[model samples]
Target: MTRHYLRNASIDQPLNVLVATPAGGTGQGGIDRIMAALKAELERRPNGVIARFAPTRGKGALALSLFHLTHFCARIAAWRLQRRLDLVHINLSSRGSTYRKIVIAACARMMRVPYVIHLHGSEFRSFWSNSSPIVDRSIHALFEKASRIIVLGTPWQAFIAERVPNAHGRIVIVPNAVEEPRVAHVGGGASVHILFLGRISDRKGVPHLVKALARMKDVPGWRATLAGDGAVDDLKSEITALGLADRVTVPGWLGPEETARLLATGDILTLPSHAENLPMSIIEAMASGLGVVATPVGAVEDIVKDGKTGLLVPPGDDSALADALSRLVQDGELRQRLGAAAQAFQRRHLSIGPYADRICAVWQDAAAAHRGEASLPALVTPTDLKA
Candidate 1:
């Protein structure tokens, strides 16, 4: 397929976009980061897209989160009355996220506003495949009503087309993007630094990562940091048991600034997860010009082309993971090449400027479709990002 870009000129009037998500600027999830970055980027640009964030979930209990959702619904009614709502862009995952967005979409439909669905859940396939028939119908209904459905990558676009055939024409692939690194990347001092950014759990393959590092204990001049929340103690214990306590640092979770500092000095970004949906960490790392070593899961293959941008190891295979890491650790030339290519890939396909352009184009299309006007030309899709 030929790569195409959206050529629509900037809107004459400000486009009011109500963004609904779990936690717009406060949450630690990938969806939150993407929304936060998009919001910040849009604010800096005069693109005429006035994005108003409406966080549906919070860090509090379920009832508290639901209360927030209730408030969001009320705001929809209020905004509609004021004639301020032009479109809604919902950032959604599976489970509770889907349920909450269902209500938000219903409210949008009731208020006669066009809304778009952006799927961000990595485990959505399992969540949908194991759901009851009634639940399946509800999900299908949600997508059926969406004016446009956005996915992180081609695989997810295919999933939506297969599951919700009627919505196939509306599906768009706009992978998550990250802002450029604020601090210049100075290669890891002395030793090769391997950084892992994400939750610390079996699902992220933390245990397997620990074992892999243990196998590479004999490989000199290398250290690792497994950063994020969840099962921190278990991971620390396993690292100690493997006698990799000296080389691996388990720093529960990092704030944005801390993570940025690490990225500035890190040489390689690693995430050996068993499941994912285009992790923001990889994008962030690539933006920092770091070589990546990750497992091929979720939409990871969409970005991390093995031997080109980064080295890929089979998930849960500690031996292969160790070998890949060792090769990168010993080959400075290969590390430089991969890191350079990964950074170039990020600039070409995942930079924030083009990402915001694509999203705004989608919002324009959705609103136009809702108003019974001809839709704008298609926006940039995954195929368009290919070199």
Candidate 2:
């Protein structure tokens, strides 16, 4: 029952794409990775394609008001440009303001330009819960109307398929790919250096990770590093409350090189999020050759193969998380085996080249379809897209 998009040779030409993303860039999460990958693909074009990086402002708005305004401006700018632009690729979070999605999608339709909707994280679930019956119907209408729907993993594909069966054929899964770091085989010891990198938010389960580590205080020679910025005071207070001031290290946010260096010193990377969809941090950790310990959320199960590449526990179970960490901390052979396996997985399947190629095919197919040409067979599958 898996459908694919067939690329039409006639319409398969270099595209001028408008990539819309949140302002801060790739450091945010998977959306950032998608933007980065799309840019990389656009660079490979011989005639050179126009890929404008449009940033949305305002973080706490209900519907991302600033993003919608920015998107509108980008649309106007794209229209004014005399060059031929084939598609508007939108990296949309389900949690983004309804106004933003509606405005952007409507603009694409008005312009008669094919638009690709890239769904990230829990936005789908959020939208499903937030909308009224009428609004929900309209939202599903939008999902069905998109030229193509890009999802992160199998779970999301299923979510969309269950709601919009016909549109399942139009859905394409393209998981985030991590760049392999040059430094390899870094960090592992009795100290069992563990790094938790990401925004310091409740959703990220930072406090949960801290609580888990607090319980393990009796386990000597173990230290946890909290890198990245978010609710600084809250995280610091939690660290103090847990009496893990000494056991836990919060170095705040680090630049790419510095983050890589910090990751290079870790034996294990842990992220016990309540919800997630193919976290870039886990992929980066795997690329860094660190044993990963994460919850079974999003495409995490697809990457951390429980006792194989890494370990996965129930999302909110601190004890299970701690147990998993303890196993890797005590067993060097197991850690090496998992780390090596993870590295191999990344090398074999998660390379950026194949990922970019698949996305390029999606964009080309959408563009071709908009031009009244036959669609391309789906170049990727739900399973293929999983991290």
Candidate 3:
């Protein structure tokens, strides 16, 4: 299905692009933001670059087996399509298979197309270290061969530089961007409505939030909304077990409009994720003028100024999470001040336009480098074609 889209995309002259991801057309969260920013640039500039989305097919009953198989197949299919693409961009995650990485990197080299790899986490310490030594070495080799690498934070930039010294110059920091809030300012009140809006997985620290809510339920009118789906039964059971059913609402799997509406109603946003690589939800909340309470992870520190734009707590520390939430829930003045600062910060730095421009620049640089090496026939620019 996606291959046909790529073939049709090739017919256009600007620059035919392919976005290989596990996410199909749904475009939720960070993936959605990326696709939207890229599409906007392609539409406005008519860069002939049409991004085609492809989802990897998983196999096996076990979660690990399914993950491995899906990554392997996705890479193989992407490797085959490298010949047709002028440049290939890979979104690297912690869960990818080593075999798939080798195959995909080899294909990029064989096709002689410049490939850009985007790093989204501190996956090296969390997942890769636990895997076999051979797998670790293979993953290192994959990072070394990339034409360019994209990172969201200084920590990742330093991590990649220290570990993969040779590839230091190729690393580009392009933080995730968020769309500006659309609705009227729907914040500032006594009864603070907090939200945790993402996958309810262990890594996300959903259980931690539940426990914190259980402790703080005695605070008058303190409520929370968990607006996503993942381990739904487990989360629900935990909430029930903790006696937080009245305080924390699990309204599962909200669509964009619903999600945005819920966010607008929220007085504050909190995400106590164990790990992250610049969560878009936090940025969206900031854009919506809501104070944030999150664990210091990924590019969060870059946006959130502790006690100013938002409050930061240590990851997995349920006590600190509860403390931060309680502080905001009790002080209306503090919440409004943080919310305003967050809104201003997001408007100044995290808007989608700048993100679009940066990504387009990266793509153009990669495309230009590929063209220079290949010495392909000069093609007309979009403006030239129009003329």
Q: How many residue pairs clash in each candidate?
A: 1, 11, 3
Encode model 1's per-residue lDDT on 102-220: one tens digit a residue: 88989989998889999989899899899999888888888999999999888888889999999988998888899889788897899999999998888888888888888998999
Write one digit per residue (lDDT tens) for candidate 3, span 25-125: 24555655465555554566443455554443232243554564456445545654665456666666665534544555666677566677777644445
* Model 1: ten consecutive residues of lowest lDDT: 1-10
TM-score of each: 0.95, 0.88, 0.81
Return the TM-score for candidate 3, rounded to 2 decimals. Answer: 0.81
| Top-TM-score candidate index | 1
Alpha-carbon lDDT of model 3: 0.70
Tell me the lDDT of candidate 2.
0.73
For candidate 1, what is the lDDT?
0.86
What lDDT score is found at residue 35 in candidate 3? 59
Candidate 3 runs further than 4 Å off: 1-13, 44-50, 57-84, 97-102, 122-124, 182-185, 188-190, 371-387
Give the distance in Å from residue 68's predicted Cα in candidate 1 to where it truly belongs.
0.8
Candidate 1 at 145: error in angstroms?
A: 1.0
